[model samples]
Target: MRYLFLLFMLFTFQLNAQVVADDFEGFGTIYSWYGDDCIVDANFLNPYQQGINVSNTVLEYHDIGGQYANVQFDIDTTYDLTMNNSFSLNVYVPSSGLTGSEINQISLKLQDKNIEFPWMTQSEIVKPIVLDQWQTITFDFENDFYINLDSNSLPPIERTDFNRVVIQVNGENNDDEVLAYLDDVLYFDTVSNNPIYDNLVWFDEFDGNGPVDASKWFKQTQLIAGDSWANGELQHYTNRQDNSFLDNGSLKIVAKGETYNDQDVTKDYTSARLNSKFAFQYGRVEVRAKLPSIAGTWPAIWLLGKNINEDGGYWDAAGFGNTSWPLCGEIDIMEPNVAKNQILATWHWDNGSGYQINSNSVPSTNANTSQNWHIYTLEWSEDTMKIYMDDTLVNQMDSVNPFNQEYYILLNVAMGGSLGGDIQPGFNQDAMEIDYVRVYQETPLSVQHFEKNKVSFYPNPVQNKLHIDTHQFANTNTKVQITDLSGRIISKKQYAENGDTLIYNTSALNVGVYFMTLSFDNGINQTFKFIKQ
Candidate 1:
């Protein structure tokens, strides 16, 4: 049943959306990739295949002490950055292959390849890299900090002259020898013209000052392991009002430096962990939150599969427990590493072999999460899942296997965990305040009804033919049109004198969602949605 649903989703939503700029797999839209003052092997075999990227082929860049060593690709058409401004790539830089003491960093620059001197007008975003492992990094011109080589140049989103992407390792002008492996270079515009998720289904506004709504949230206070939680966290999650409560119209999950004992275990710090009672298949989740800034604090807004066989989870208590941890899937919408001042979004699942994770990290929008409130969003659909920070896309991955199942939400703050290194001395208390959490799903298609005209249609999920009856207004001239979800017209016709029935041959239409409209000469129009199977 699940596999059939997955196939249905793929057939219904698959459209011509070009997001992968290059992956070196013979399927990328871009065909012109070259190097500037460097050596590039476009069809090199993968040397390290254990980490995030494990493709058979990759792009190997070797900068043998060139002054301006980089790899670049050019497109024939200039990009409208205001619409499509997000780009990402997976990079692996090994310390054994590097020669100089330059900082370990990768920079992605956008330039006008047609210009005589592209470097003078280039805009670049630099990200620090790890030495031995593969890491996926995103460059969001609309969100990340960028530098324009020419001071007089406008911001990346305001310009429309970018036709080339240049990727450089370490500082370019220095005589530093660096070797890096790159794959899955992607570019996309997060905005959707025909959004499926538009109807709000569930929400929590944290209205009054008191305990959280019992019917909507469950406090998971039971200890999972022997004496501590997973990941070496020092916090004992409790249901006490001091730990989780509503104050001043906001939900506050507080962590304090106090000795707490629960379930025969004692911890020096205490916090709250909440599991939303609601579980959903696929939808859009929006959370407006202000994070805790203490060095030892790890605050997260995440989701876990409803079938996860966790003892203390809300869904588990409700008899939906079966699958294990990574196989059940995990989606981390927002997790803040306070020490690094960065926000990480990740997806974990089993890819028929072992645990696989796809992740991306971006610097906090304001460099201080506690000082500002930001809206973190997760847009999940049949084909893809996207995570956004204040409307700027930070991460995107294909929807597969475990992600097709239902999942519930989890919000918590842990202290001194694996990701959170050490506790700050004399830290008393800190709170993560959340304004609201809202979930939205796609609106179902309405029943076709035209009262005055008395129009009707058959074969909604049409394969090759559609039949419509419009004999009630026989004397009136009407126009019929069919369009795709993006408002691109597909077919149009005019009926001079209305007949008893009209037939449309839809064999040429693609297998996706489309709209059909009927417009009469009397200024009356009606539209209905249909699917071409």
Candidate 2:
């Protein structure tokens, strides 16, 4: 047995040694990527300039009254890239038509094979000018995050091979007059040698036809107070395309103030809410998203109990499990209050019984939570729950109180709620975009026996109370304790002279895995695994 154990240890170490590189460095030549024209060959693009009244050059400076300009390039053919790895690109925009308040739109995109556009941060890649000369534009694909690329959404990429690249003018802003310039678009290598994460189990690239996958998600459409949400929330959610759309390899949940269905009442708000029906007990959950920045916007990524309705009550109704306001646990993995530009991770739970339970919150370490896209994640185990912002563990719960139940995922941009209060006047209507939500499960490790005694328990996976027979050690002083997998002690009791058997009332325990330990005065200990139903 010792020899076999040593062999297993050696194999585990070898597996951990195999590191996969995430960062990639691209070659420095632009000519190496172009086929014939000075134009860079890419996966997809729509430089509107070729349409009628637009410029194709990277250097142009006239906004046509009703005209526009754009440039498109495909990166798929430029490098052999994997969604599991990171890649970088270089872009040069020597000058852009920027007056005091005029924000000219220039963008970087990771397009699907169809050449549809999903613009990156600032909605317009900003280029600070030095002089009137050509400036070296450096775009690191890995450094500057774009639309999320998942296992299935990333277009086929190759070395010096690309599908498309595009640059466009904001026809709504420019009087068909502002001109933008670009040059030296290149792809390079990344720096990741070993991934901190690889245990992905499920995800939706939102690449197929339809309103997300119905089997994986459910859409809610009960307009609250003339809007689909309450708390004076701004966006009026609808199934209509104007408020929500699935195009260009993304699921766009736009919040606008347009007339659709039969409501002519205008206050400026339209959006969409998508919920996950697949409940999970304990695992890692992550979402890569670009949040909306409107003043009244209350965007959030959170979780809800799966059996919330088992008690015969609606979500917001009165006494339902712990849902009794602060008791019925709420895990807010990511929430951006807009005006603050800060991200918050919080937890709310009912302390066994109360009008309001205890709650905690922590600000994220990253700056400008709503300006750029970011990956927000939560790690939940048997005894503890942790929240991670961009690879940093910020907040954690380890009291072993009562958070060991199944929970489903929820993502939405509420206008107003108990948290955001209500939408104020003059709020912009923009979408809270989501790239994708992914789940991963870690491999369980083998157990090593510590100490043992003759004390025994029977009929595990019990439906009612449990009984422990201490007939084997009649004179030993034994203390009993029950703890969950996360190492949170749930219940503890002491026993005197061990004669026949002792009974434990477990009517209040939830259905899940648990551990029971019995310690004697002589330092002897015995542990047993059990389940409660």
Q: Highest TM-score, which number?
A: 1
Q: Candidate 2 lDDT, tens digit per residue, 309-393?
A: 3222223233334444444467888876445445677776666744332233434335556566678898777645767677654
Which ten residues in a row are the worst by lDDT in model 2? 1-10
Best by lDDT: 1
Tens-digit per-residue lDDT, 284-328, candidate 1: 999999998888988999999999988888899899999998999
Once superposed on the true structure, which residue ranges of model 2 sit more than 4 Å away at CA? 1-199, 208-210, 223-230, 259-268, 310-327, 355-366, 399-402, 417-428, 443-533
Assess each prediction's global lDDT (C-alpha) against the native.
Answer: 0.80, 0.50
lDDT of 1 at 179: 91
TM-score for each candidate, following the candidate numbering: 0.61, 0.43
How much lDDT does candidate 2 score?
0.50
Q: Pairing residues by index, what is the TM-score of model 1?
A: 0.61
